[model samples]
Target: MTDHSYEFTRAITRRPGQSITRGLRAVDTGAPDLDLMLAHHADYVATLREAGATVTELPPLEDFPDALFVEDTALCLPEGAVLMRPGAPSRLGEVAHMAPVLRDLYADVRVIEGPGFIEGGDILTTGREVLVGRSARTDAAGVAELATILKDWGRPLREVATPPGVLHFKTDCSLLDGETVLSTERLAASGCFEGYRVILTADGEEAAANAIRFNRFVLMAAGFPATAERLRRAGYEVREIGNSECAKLDGGMSCLSLRL
Candidate 1:
C-alpha cells in the first residue's frame, strides 16, 4: 500500500470502555451509551471483515475512557508503524497500552518523543506523499519528527493546516482513492490538498467527509442520505453504518481503528 492506497489485510481495534462517556470531547455531544456503542463497534468489525480485513478486536480498557478511538494512538504504514504522542494527556497512556501489541505485529515500530504532540487523526496518506495536518493536536515539531521517522520511505511530507472548527484534518476530509479526496466545502476551500482532486461532500453532509475507503467499500456514517447517494453515483460501494453515539463525542468512522 502506498500512502493513499490501502488494501488493508488486517486491522487492530479496541472496544469502547465503560468509562467512555468520560472521554474528552471538544463539544458536549451527549454521553455514549455503552451497550449501544458496543453494538456499533461490533457492526464496524463486521464491516471491516466484509471489506476483506482480518480483524483483531482488543478487549476494552477500563482505565481509558476514550480507548476505543485507537487510531489516534498510532499510524500503520506499509514500511512500519509509528506510535504517536497524543496531544491530550489523558490519552497519552493509550500509546503505552498499544505499543506491545503493535510491536508483535510490526517488525519495526517507531515512537514519537515529546515535547511534540502528534495523533494519527491528523495524518493523511496520498500514496506519493504523506499529508501531515498541523492542527492544535499536531504541531510543527511533531510533523518534523514524523518526517524524520518516515524519511526511509522517501515520500515528501506535505504539511496542511486543519480547517478551523475541525478537531482533526480527517474530520472534514478523507482520501477516496489515490488521486481523489472527499471533503467538506470548508476543507476544500482550505487549499490543504493542492495537486489532488477534491470531491466536496453533499451540502449539509459534512460528516460524510470522514468516511473511510476500506478495501472494496466506502464505509461512512449513517443518516447522511444525500452524501451516501452521491458516493454511490460516483461508482463506490458505500456502506452506511450507525454512529450516532460516537458522533455525540466527535468521533468518526476513521477514529475507531488502525487499518493496515
Candidate 2:
C-alpha cells in the first residue's frame, strides 16, 4: 500500500479589515493583538517546512485578506483535490484562488460546484472512508455531490451530523488512526459518533479538539499546553505551533491548510 503523508502551506492574512468585512466579524477587538496573531501564522508556515514537508507560500488574494480563505473551501486527496463551495456567500471566491494551487500539485483535480455549498474543514478522509460533517456550513446537496465524485475514485463517503453548538465534525472528533479516534466526551456522549473507539479529553478544550494527522505525526496548536501534553503522552509525536491569529478569525491548525 502507498503511504499517504502530506505537506501543508498557508497564505498569511495581511489585511484583516478587508477580510473581516466579507465574512463574520472578529469577536476580539484589540488591533495590536490581532497583528501578533498574523505573526504567529508566519511561524506556523515555518514549522511545517522544518518538519521536512514541502511548503509553498501562495500570494495573498488582493482585497480578500480572508484569502487565507483556502481552508474554508477545498480538500486535497492523493489522486486530486475537490474544490469546495463555501457556505458563506462572501467566501465563494476562495475556490477560484485555490484551484491553480491544487492543479500545480495534482493533475486530476476537480470541483464541487453548486447548487450546493461545502466547506473543506468539515470533511475528513481516512484509509477506510471519507467522512463529511453535515453542518450549517456544509449542506446535504454538497454531501451528495461529493459522494458522487468520490464514487468515481472508488472511495466511499459517509456523513455525520455536527449538531448545533459544536464547531465542526473534526473539531469535535478526529481519527487518530485506523482503529482509534480522538474525540471529546461531548460528541461521544451525544450518541452521534457511535462506532469509533473514543478517547476523551479530561477538561473541555474545544481548541485542542481539531488536529491534523500527517503520516505518524499530528500537528496541533501550541497555546493549549494541557491538551497538547495529554496527546503527547498518548505515544503520538505532536508538533505544536502558535495559531493565535488564525484563532482570532475562528480558524485552527487544520483550518489553515489542506494536507495531502
Candidate 3:
C-alpha cells in the first residue's frame, strides 16, 4: 500500500538565521524579529518531534535569507525527492544547497533542470494525484517538466492555477488528508479542488489556510482561533505555533519543512 501523503516518518527543517529578517515578502509588514523567530522555530521542531517524526534540523544558511523556508526548494515523496528550480532569482541557489541534503536521504533524487521555473511551494501531493499550481513563481514550462518527472514515477500530475496575487498555490490551501483540503474560499472558488472535500478558512482568517497535517497533528499558525476550532470540530488534532515573525515574511507552518 502507498503511504498517505501526510503520513511522514521524517522531516527536514533549517534553523532561522540573522538574515531571516530580510526574507522575501509580498507585503512588508515589518522586518522579522530574529530572536522571536528562533524561539518559535524551536517550538515548531519540537512539535514535529512530538508528533513522532525524526526531524533533521539543518544549520542556518545566512547567505540565503529565505533559506529557512525550505519547502520551496524541493518536493519530498516516498519514491524519491525532486529538486525545484525556483522562479525567484535570489532563491535559485537555495536548491543547490538542498540537493546534497536530499541526496543523503534518498537513493533516487531528480532535478528539474528547467528552462522554466517551479517551486516546491506550488506543488501539493494527494493520495490520488500530484497537483501543480502555476503562480508568479511556478510557470507552465516548469509544471510540464514536473509532470514529466512525476510520470516516470507513475504519479499522475494535475495542472492548476494559484489564486491571483498569492505568493504560492499553498498560500491559499493545504492538504488535510488524502481527500480533504483546508483552503481559503477564494482559492476554493476556483474549482481547483473539484473532487476533494474542502474546508474554507474562517472569513477573516485566510492566513490559516496554509497548514500542514503531519502524522497525527495538524500544525497551523497560532492566533486563528476560528480556523483552529473549525479544524478541531472536523476531528483533527490541531497544534498551533507562534507565527508572528514568520508571517511578516509570508512564511507559515507548511513553509518551514520538507516531510517524507
lDDT of each: 0.88, 0.69, 0.93
What does the lDDT read for residue 187 in candidate 2? Answer: 70
The segments of candidate 3 whose C-alpha lies over 4 angstroms from its true place after superposition are none
Better of 1 and 3 by TM-score: 3
Model 2 segments more than 4 A misplaced: 1-34, 191-195
**lDDT for residue 106 in candidate 1, whole number 0-100:** 91
Per-residue lDDT, model 2, residue 220, is 80
Tens-digit per-residue lDDT, 1-260, candidate 3: 54568998899999989888778999989999999899999999999999999999999999999999999999999889999999989899999899999999999999999899999889899999999899999999999998998999999999998988999999899999999999999999999999999999999999999999998899999999999999999999999999999999988899999999
* Cα lDDT tens digits for candidate 2, 35-111: 56557667666666665556666766655656664667677777677888888776787778777777877888878
Per-residue C-alpha lDDT of model 1 across residues 1-260, encoded as one tens digit per residue: 33336578888889988788898888886888889988988999999999989999999888888888999999898789999998888889999999999999999999999789999999888767888888878988899999999897676788888987789999998878888899999988878777887778998889889988887889999999998888888888999888989888889999998998
> Cα deviation in Å at residue 25, candidate 2?
4.8
User: Clashing pairs in model 3?
Assistant: none
Question: What's the distance in Å from true for residue 255, model 1?
Answer: 0.4
lDDT ranking of the models: 3, 1, 2
**What's model 3's TM-score?**
0.98
TM per candidate comes to: 0.97, 0.86, 0.98
Q: What are the clashing pairs of model 2?
A: 37-245
Model 3, position 106: C-alpha lDDT score: 98
Tell me the alpha-carbon RMSD of every candidate.
Answer: 1.3, 3.1, 0.8
